[model samples]
Target: MAVLGLQVVFSLVMFTFLHKLAPYFSVGRWLLSKRLSRYLHPTNDELKQLSSGNQPGKTTGQTSKAKRRAEQRRNAASAQADKSESFTVPRNLPIQLDQALVEDIDLVPLQFYSEYTWLMDFSLCSLVIYVLTEIYFIITPHRLEFNLSILWCLLAVAFCVRVLASQAWIYLRTQEGGERILLVTFTFFFLVFAMGVLIVGDNVIEFGIEEGYKNFSTSATKFLEQQGMTSHGPVSFLTFKISLAFFGMLVGTLLTFPGLRLAKLHVDTLKYSQDRKITQLLLQINYLLPLLLILLWVKPVGRDLLCGKTFSKVKPVFYEDQFEGFRLLLVVVMCGLRILLMPKFMQAHLNLAHEKIESIKKESGRITNIELQKTIARVFFYLCVVAIQYVAPVLLILFLTFLLKTLGGLSWVSLFGETAVSFFTPTSKPGMKLPKLGGENSTLGTIMDSAAEFTSTLGDIRGIFTPVWYRGILNFFLWWVLTVWFSSTSLGVMYYSQNL
Candidate 1:
């Protein structure tokens, strides 16, 4: 009560002082005029009448009508001014900063940059790549552990230096632009954003790793141990592989949305005509190359850490699963070249894009849709050939899925100079049997036929990857569902692992 009374007394004293000082302070008088004018504003006629000091008999209705018309005119002018303001985001902001970094750079393919700029790019890419490696540790049956090894110390020191380099680069760049105050602010905010994103990823990955460890340590691996079939490699490899595939795709999808958003901004904002291929290639190098390297380097055992059970065992064993985590990671990433790249194909739709998607799109009459399709196909084929290391044929299914999505039902078959089989029904109510390729009794041809039928049902990867046909936000939500499902499974595994 005493504090409340003192507050009221302080407020009264301040109000009295402000009232007395209104005439002396320009700011105070302006504020007072604003507050008082709201209820006292007069129309032109009233102002003229006041100036003339004339009293002409007029109905209250006439004065009210004049006031209404004046208010309407003022409101219309305000709305017109508001409409003229552009919706463009400020340049060099954390969310939009990557645009400025590339806007002024040239697109000469394979050209190198200056030492400091290269150093800056390296540092920025390292932060992103480390985030990816951290993710691999979580879902690949390996929990990150600090080691006393000297190599570990070197790597740790390098990472610390990288962080400092990113800060210095931002500061120096802002300094060059003559925004001295923005140097500290941009560096600080961007660091916070980077750390926040990595931390969220870490928590998600850590939770899954910890839970999976619990699950197999007790019941699943325990059951296999009783049967004397306990090999964490294959024992929990399937679960781990599925989790990695889902998580990798999930991360890839998330990266695509923001990646394309930034790329779209570049397409929209840059004053010069950009070389589409080189621009996109540079983007992939800066934002995506590290993640790709981490995915490719991942092996069930040799490259990655041991399983939770294996790591926690009395003596740890280091052997990888045959075609589990790494292979799936490869496929999940490989199929997403288009998925990770919508802004590259941002159409020339004027309503959706405030600026042209790319001036290059309009520059050439020879850059046909067929050429675009072929370009996509050529890259995908090479990527598959490189990443599909073991049981390399498994990627065939993923590739087939991609084809089905991009090319309509029978159109893909036509590309190979082959015909698609349709309704192979028997004349007399008996169904047609798939014939053997090797021999009458051989199972391989029938298995091939069955696989084809199954793959046909997997639906469209093309429709989802294409910017014109895709719903990016919806695709992201589906990946989120996968995260939730697998995350829950890990928790269940942990719960039972504890009890058993």
Candidate 2:
């Protein structure tokens, strides 16, 4: 069967064209460039002038040269004394920063802006291709030999993980701030937690990994035998579970800061948007939805309770199939909600400058002009970094769900009145030969056949990379990732309420 399908073509276009177009037309850049209320940083000279009782908007007789000489004298005296001395401005001085728009063109040079823009643009393109693929399947008679949208999704997931790892790396490399120690501690904790959870019987957690793997192994063995192939089935069960735990550790590490940042954004958004009751309500919902998603997979809490005996006596509220579809749908909706409220979150992050100024106003000690300026300017400087942290994890879960739906052979059509599309049986017309590369005797055709043969051989030996195999693996990781996100976010919220 030819693997080069319409979806594959779309993937190729996305890979090639999007990189060029992203700089000029990117959702990340658009989101960041939106007109926002920002506080300007006070210059060192301005701070000194204010300290010297020079009110804003009033011209003093002092020349720029005079100010420089005065600053130089103060610096020399402080240097000789081996200590610093600086003038202090009034704590409650009425200082209003000049408001400015975060121009789209200015974002090109900001740290992480390019990375954020590319990730967002690629993810968006991949999503469009995925929807088109779903639509293509609906009207076409041919069954997909392989969903190439999975490749796009896999790449999206990879990029998201890389962004997350890079973000985490920043903390690990820090010499001070206790951030490295804190991250290491959390990674170790999550690792221990992941290992501990693996021991729990399927009855309690109901991850179904064990059952899924057994089913996969049996299917792979039979399929290989029929193909004149010999092999032990997939990796050992113990090895599989151990690998999952280690992956959980990595996820835990990557998510640590994002979760913490999420909590901070949530609190700040809620604080600032108090006047807009609707926005506040949405903020609360966005913050809490992950917890709801986490609970849905637990058999005792989610499945047994809602779809339990009481509801099952007459008829189940959700059939087994419908329930699974609902879980996928929920993740999609949650991700959408976050994206929708992105402006509010970004604005809240931007307002950190104002908030810092307010915080400094409450302090009694003198602050240097450089310190004050950085306290305000740093927020704008790293706006894109904050944005990357905010969006990476959300995209991670969203694309992962896309992969789950395609690779697990689940259907979106099922949610909208039709039965789920099952990929288990061939949907193409009977006896139709799947397309081959070029002519049978051509070099391209031979190379394609060789490649296909190699792929088959690899699958036969490594346990068939079947939909069922992916279903089980994706199902567990999807649930685990959700649990980790909610856990970390919950901890962050507590830390803010208690400590911050």
Candidate 3:
């Protein structure tokens, strides 16, 4: 508000002054040019006399004075041009370099931003696959139990993506100028989506450990006991899916490390705040924060505090409980390390932005050069707007998935209380024992047990997918509309770029 007020006041003052002087501006310019020309050059006849050496010594003096004034006028014109360009220069992408005055940009941060942005878009597309696969399981929980169903779906998605990319390329060839950026953004979006869906679905492992009471006794033991081992325990590792998912997620984290610099940069202002209201900052945070939060705190804490149930000892996502009651100590340490390096990224981004601005300023000494540089910046800015909005829907989905697991899991624990623990946690006592069921009833027991497993499996399937889609799809569409609207402005700018 304060900034807006100052701008309004400044504008009113400048316009009022300009309006009062409107009558005199042209007359003053003409008078000034005429007075300067007297010093700059004599009349044409006087120049002829000087060139013919008709006035001898007087002509030499006049000619030397004329030469000095001409040089001064040229210098003044150059300085005025510099002054005008400073105010009129466009504030967008400045990729051009001046041949005479150009310097190499050492802190090349924009390329990293480009790559990081692409990776994020790609990762969001990957998340859609996860959500879609989960949705399939929810709708037909009884069927599609076989892994091959999902595998085929992934394969189909990849093929479809390839077709779409080719079509997009053909369509892009039909367009030119800034409009092409819109096509490029969507083409790459689909391409990233395909990669996300295909890259990690091939390798899958279905692992289970059976637990039941035996010998007409209440004591529970694992059916798949370790070979020749006396001790009975639940599976000591995470589901293979979670394990591989964690790995893919970590690599994604590495890809987005550079973007976190925005968190620390411009912290004193609202420019790059950590608030949910700031959509650009939110989008960036949503891209990386959820997986990070899960990796750091949610999974580890849930495992320990949820109940006696815990994450498998093998490849535990968080550190051991040895951190003075903070099981997420290692996660905290790792995230802190990532934070520590952010200032370097911020510095790099700042250096690159400043360098681009300086390069444009240095090159903007002529009207043509000034217009050219400003046009480049304007187009670049428009393209960036398109890029930011293009990936918004996908990123929102990814963050929604993260929020579901973290919040839903916590809510389930709270709502069910101890019953939830008892239900999910396996029988506490573990030992191999004999069943005392009579032969006649043995078959009945077997059927009943099978029925129980089916019920449990169905429940697990719902648990896996429903929360992801519950509000996810609806919210995505709502935000998707807003993004399209925001990106439409870029489309207009793209159209305007040609005239620029």
Candidate 4:
């Protein structure tokens, strides 16, 4: 009961804090305004002069005076034209982040929280139903008490931290693009560390009953045995492998949405002729992809799949076949989509490139072909970096998982020797003597003892080293990233084409 109350309180705190913060973090608005001013609005000086109170016909009104004034006006106009031509326009002009745009940005976070509320409400109701069922069982003399308070606490903490960091990072990026690298770096590190702690500390077991653990462990062991594999202790490797696969699939799916959206926008931009359209598409893709990838793929995938258990001890063959099928389907669909859209994507890139080059040539007729090539190369380099930024972390996680598993056998051997030495001592004096059993008897006895000791001492270590929940985490992350990325990217493309 107390645990239930705590869950409710945590939910309230999270909702309330996010509700208050919803308006302050507005990336979309900042991007929109920046793009608008850069591609549409005239420079500050131009606007200022147009709005200025200075005029030519104030006090003088005679034929001779009028002629002198007209002559003076012609000279002034020529001078102004020269000045305009000489003025150097700023690149990547900063937009004034305002309250109205901030309010517009609030809608997204509010809608997100509103959806979250429905989920929490359903969860709370389900929990009540579960408690009532347990009570009925208890009345019939069945042991029914199950505590999930600690696990709930951990999950709440994880969720809150993830949301808070995400919002903070977004807010910081919009307010000042200067610290984006630092903020994103910090967020990534925080998520990885939190997930590591959650996994290593075994926080997930607190969520359910002891029976749950037994069922899971037994199922895992049987599955492994069926595969002609034997473990000295619990078979956590299968669980971890399944988890990672699921995470990868989920991440892939989640990423697909945004990827598709970006692909579509690139297609549209290719068909369009305006630089504004291209810029808007670029900004939208940049802002949405990072946040979506980080929130949906990075944090959730790691925590849910690596630390949480969603799959019971299932057959490796079942999981492997399912994953392979899903991967094939995903790749096929994505490839098809890419193929269909390839012409548009390429055309958009080329069109934008050509448009930019023309604009530069018009501005400076003396610009050389070599200089243009250098500029194009710089732009392409930045684009590549952006692509890498989103992909590298995911690949790194996959690599680390495999690398650790490959060294698992050596790790076990080293641990075994160290543990045996720590537990036993050699005596040279007195009547102390080691058992002198020979052949199979000695080997069998030693193997059995080693198995027992290792199982007892290294159960948690094995769990930590092997991932058993990655699939779910990865899936959750991927779903989120794809949703956000696709939506935002689409909007950006639309906004640019229409408004620009």
Candidate 5:
């Protein structure tokens, strides 16, 4: 009740400001507003002019002279036809692709642009609340009754999942792309992989999920008994692991298309940026960072390598809790790097038009003008959809980590030892009688009394959803997301490499 008033006021003010300002300003729109060169699709006249070996606006005499030169070359080629395989090369055909700048106005009509804007705006709002909450906690000893920031982060994650699922659904609706089958196949594979990981001994993987669940169950059982409710813990061990496996399966399906899209963009980005060694290096690092995060939880390799002697049970370096802190930090860094390089990835995708035009030049057959136009135009048209695929997974992972930090009782500053405090501070000591309000028998007294009751109810709810349970579930989720991301992306990269 002490700090609730200020927190509520701050949240409302920020929410209202964002809600109103969103129309005039948005991070998503701004990101897409960056001007990039786009190739203009060739018109029928242009293709015909190239195919006929004639230049536009040429005088009649110049056209006749050009035709005579072409006829002479064809005669010479025919004279030597018996000596060499016959082929006709179009003369005076130069592919000078005109370029235009793609701006925010161009993206406004693109598919998924609104959804992308909403997602980015919501993510920004969620981040603001989280940062404010953290600052409030740091300065005040009185604890937050219920962290609204957690609610915001949860909403952001849910929204991201919905967007990704919709993207996957688009593939399913097509039915002929094999994408539908791939999604189903990969989901099952991840489910089996999740179960396998869960069954392995903690000595090998070190998730500590089993221990955390045991502690949670015992705590919950005691709390239930004290409240005169009967329970055999919350769920059986087998049931828990099965539920976890299903969750992992969901993550796998959501990430499948994003991973593949990333791989395609990565390969294209490399091709588009052949001369820029630094950009290529960053792309590789961003692609491989997930694997490094996954290895951080592997007991024999990640933890043992850094905190102790390799392949040994010994411990000598920093505290075990610090390892968790470092992992969290790395995820944050990777998310930042991905955001920074988003423009590069997006531009690489946009350059598909140029690439397609170049590839068409290599073919000997004539391409219909409509087909050529669609090839160049669709790349810029689907810009927003591609942006969604790139941004969704990164946002999901970022906010999930924030939820894990808060719910798992971990701290962003765990390395410096400023761990998160308890959720609330009581107005009075335990077992003490409630004091009379400052103004007895008045409206203010009644309001204070109601506030106290509300705070108590919130406290009871927090007790049921304890951090021990959160630690188990969240750790499993974070690990599963990282594992599936690395596996899918690595597979996608290899697939593209071989096929291309």
Candidate 6:
């Protein structure tokens, strides 16, 4: 539990720091360009002027003062004309396109091919196999589990088809319009979803069970034993399914921070001409603080505390009571810190966004139909990705909570309490009292116990779907949304004099 807490804290801190550092990183690139300019080749015009012995900054010592002044004025006028035409005269501009830049751009296509194109081919092959196998099963429909297996096969095929279609669309539209950030974001999401389906599909195929559905009792027994925790009741497959959905959603949500940040940076780069160092710094700081806070809260107190056997042992009661208090306190402190920093962060984001919008408006001059369509498409895509990243996990968690209640007779409050305890408690205690089962509880308990035992015996079966690190992104999103909503409402009422 302590390790988990520390991990979470570390991730949050890293994210915060990255966000704050983005602008400075951008500035660093600009600085590097400026410093390297001296090494760049002279432009054609510059070379011509130098070869012709017509240096703008040079004046012969014998030349009359008035003539020199007139020459300077002429040069100034020419420079102004060049500026009006948006022409820049680089003293040491590159004679040829930088090989590194060419490589960077070319690598994007190679990456696209490797990540999406290759995946598409693999999915297509899988779909073909699935279809052929399903048809064979249909022809020999004498089996009891035929229908279930067929459904599972169909689902597998459908997912593969969807993957293929999405990849094709991305490829087709890649040239028409798409930011690097947007493409990368979608690609990552697609890969995550594809990996999940593949994992689940492999499990189903191996078990020869339709959709890999295990009996409730069997699954419950297996899960408890796997956790090395004594089960007083059965576990439900439905409950397990719900948990998996929540887990996926949480993973997706955690992934969104990087995607959103990338999208924002892309948008900003397109929209703003000025540097955004401060804005980036604020974002990085925001990401870093949460992680640091988690680390601070989780790190062992001292050598004495580390050596203490009593402190090292996991106690459920300690997690449920003491850990809860500790978490609550930590949350309060973090929230307070965020609130204090909110004004600065909001200012930076808004200012950068506003500047970008203004720049876009100026650049467009008159928005054409094609430009408008591109803008709308980009907006839609950004919204879709953001919404999926933020809302999916929350919905998944809620769905899991609901399913667990219905199928396992698990109380939502008690389950959360258990989760809290499991997360915080140091591992040492032998046995703890399980939460009481509610409506239709005994039957479910039996099913869960049997399932748990079966799963324990087959270690490979349990390993198929478990995630290494569980990120509670949904929980964070829920809190953030609630905070924003309340804040907005309070501000609205205060300004409108509604309370008065």
- lDDT by residue (tens digit), candidate 2, 1-500: 25656777777777677867865688887777755655566544566667777865632456476653343233223334433444556665556565456767556666887789889998899898888877777666776356677788899999999988988999999998998998999899999999998888777777777878888889877886878889887689999889989999999999888888888888888888879989888988898888898888777777676666445565556656667778889999999999999888988998988878888888776666555665776787788888888899889899889988887778765544343445422377675454775998999999988987897776665455667777878877887788888788888888887755
Question: What is candidate 4's TM-score against the reference?
Answer: 0.30
| Cα lDDT tens digits for candidate 4, 1-500 | 54243344444554554456434542223322222211111223442343353222322345476554443232223334444343233222222111111123222332233323332333233334334433343233222222233243234334433433443434455755544554444344434433443353223322111233454466556556755778544645446444544443333323322343354445455456356675556544443444433432232342344333344453322232233233323322332343333334433432344445445645632433234333433332222222222222222222222222222211212223454423332223343344644555588778867766775445543443332333333333333334334544555466555744
After superposition, the stretches of candidate 2 with alpha carbons farther than 4 Å from their true spots are 1-3, 58-94, 219-235, 308-314, 417-426, 433-463
Sort order, TM-score high to low: 2, 5, 4, 6, 3, 1
Against the true structure, what is each candidate's TM-score?
0.19, 0.84, 0.25, 0.30, 0.83, 0.26
Give the per-residue lDDT of model 3 (tens digit) for 36-129. Answer: 1111111223223433545422223455765644443432233344535432222232222211111111111222334323333333334444
In the order shown, what is each candidate's alpha-carbon RMSD? 30.1, 6.4, 22.7, 22.6, 9.3, 22.8
Q: TM-score of predicted model 5?
A: 0.83
- In Å, residue 421's CA in model 4 sits off its true spot by 47
- If candidate 1 were superposed on the true structure by all CA atoms, what would the RMSD be? 30.1
lDDT of 1 by residue, 253-278 (tens): 22222232333323332222255666
The C-alpha lDDT values of all candidates are 0.31, 0.77, 0.33, 0.36, 0.77, 0.35
Cand. 2 Cα-lDDT: 0.77
How many steric clashes between backbone atoms does each model show? Answer: 1, 0, 4, 17, 0, 40
Residue-level lDDT for 141 in candidate 2: 72
Relative to the true structure, candidate 3 reaches a TM of 0.25
Choose 1 or 5, whichever is better by TM-score. Answer: 5
The positional error of residue 402 in candidate 4, measured at the CA in angstroms, is 12
- lDDT score of residue 137 within candidate 1: 29
Q: Give the range of the ten consecutive residues with the poorest summed lDDT in model 2.
A: 71-80
The positional error of residue 222 in candidate 3, measured at the CA in angstroms, is: 19
Alpha-carbon runs more than 4 Å astray in model 6: 1-176, 179-259, 262-285, 292-321, 332-346, 357-500
Off by over 4 Å in 4: 1-328, 335-347, 361-374, 386-444, 455-471
